[model samples]
Target: MKTFISSLLLLFSFNTFAAPKSELWSYWNVSNEKNATTISHQYWQQTLDKYLITRGEFTLFDYAHVTDADERTLNSYLRQMSRIDPREYKKSEQYAYWVNLYNALTVKLILMDYPIESITKLGGLFSFGPWDEEIITVAGKALTLNDIEHRILRPIWNDPRTHYAVNCASLGCPNLQPKAFTARNSDKLLDKAATEFINSDKGVLIKEENVQLSSIYDWFAIDFGSQQQLFEHLKKYRPELKPFKGDIRYDYNWKLNQQ
Candidate 1:
């Protein structure tokens, strides 16, 4: 009976009842030049058309399983990161590494669970959410989300745009760019992310003289340029908004980003 019970427990652990993950590196190709779009506007239209973001969308994840491609891709990226000696990276590679890890691990999390209500829903004690996993082995060392963010991203690359590229799978989160991150165009990609989000109704609010906005601007106000710079940045894309005088309030919907 004890043996049978152990076998049942093992089976349950391996059950196929979990969320589905987003496909990775399938055809995503980020530009290597600054100011060049990470993903073309047309591609954004095509991809989003199929995977529209709606409320209450949930994706369950399996913390235990990973595909060969998933493993290979993450390992490849992380390995490339490891190869850059820290001294050189501070001058060049660190920012790219941080963004790459942020993006790569996000993809890994989606793959493991396939479908989750939101990335934040992966709970744990203290700093041990689903973000804390040794899922990807780099140079034979296991790395988790916390390691990527706290240890790698924050410490090395102090740039504010790091916050924009890492998607937490929420409505309030920045829009996910449909391409891989590389050092070549990191500056441009970050700017685009900032621009797109700032102009988005989801990010900014313009409703009949009553404008509510995303708290992201407040949370990472430092990232949106300076106080006056924020409005200036918006003017480039939303000239009409330049004239609108309305109360600015931030709205953040933390529900899962579902299709």
Candidate 2:
């Protein structure tokens, strides 16, 4: 019947378009906590300083040039990260932890199987990316890169800037900062990262009369509130990018950000 067919079609549409619910992890305040220890990010800092090359607005890792010693250093850093208890840290420290962990794990994943063109090539069964795999364990909870970004950071902070903080190791992503994010400097680092990305050609392209934005704006549109909100967010960072009227399109480059 017409009614039953319509009902089934609507159900199918809903299922297809639905966004998965994210889990909210507990994040404690850091302000006024005098006893909170500074989480050491020296290892990540050293690796990034030695390997990351800044070209214009984006930074690329010297993946091909990495030596066995460098790989061992990265593994040791990840091991140190695994042993830390995130719950004992302040919100600022936890924020840095999750962002650093996500970025490090991504780099490690690529290093495990280097010489790949894109991250999509590392997809698992029934998944288009390596985001769903249990890549790390911290605070006794097994977490994937997706879990760290979505479940822990996004839900806990409800901040759009969080997206800019985690590098996806792709040309299209925000640059992986040359220095590791620290609790003492997280606020300044987040703002600087967002500003740098928004002003870059990779973030927003205005050619002739058309505006092409990074696919990040489209994929995580909800985090940015609405299209108007997204535009406002961009303008907030780069005020000169305003007062233009044009058609908009979204694009992304999945090629490895390697030197």
lDDT of 1 by residue, 90-173 (tens): 333445555655655665565556566556545442221376566565444466665665555644455656666777666677
| Candidate 2 TM-score, C-alpha based | 0.87
Candidate 2's C-alpha runs over 4 A off are 1-22, 26-34, 243-245
Candidate 2, run of 10 with poorest lDDT? 26-35
**Predicted model with the maximum lDDT:** 2
Q: How far is candidate 2 from the true structure (C-alpha RMSD, Å)?
A: 6.4
Model 2 pairs in collision: none
lDDT of 2: 0.82
> After aligning candidate 1 to the native by TM-score, how far in Å is the CA of 240 from where it should be?
3.5
Candidate 2 per-residue C-alpha lDDT over 154-249 given as tens digits, one digit per residue, 9 for 90 to 100: 888888998899988899999998879888888888999999999899998889989999888878888997777888899999998776567889
Per-residue lDDT for 160 in model 2?
A: 90
* Cα deviation of 258, candidate 2, in Å: 0.4
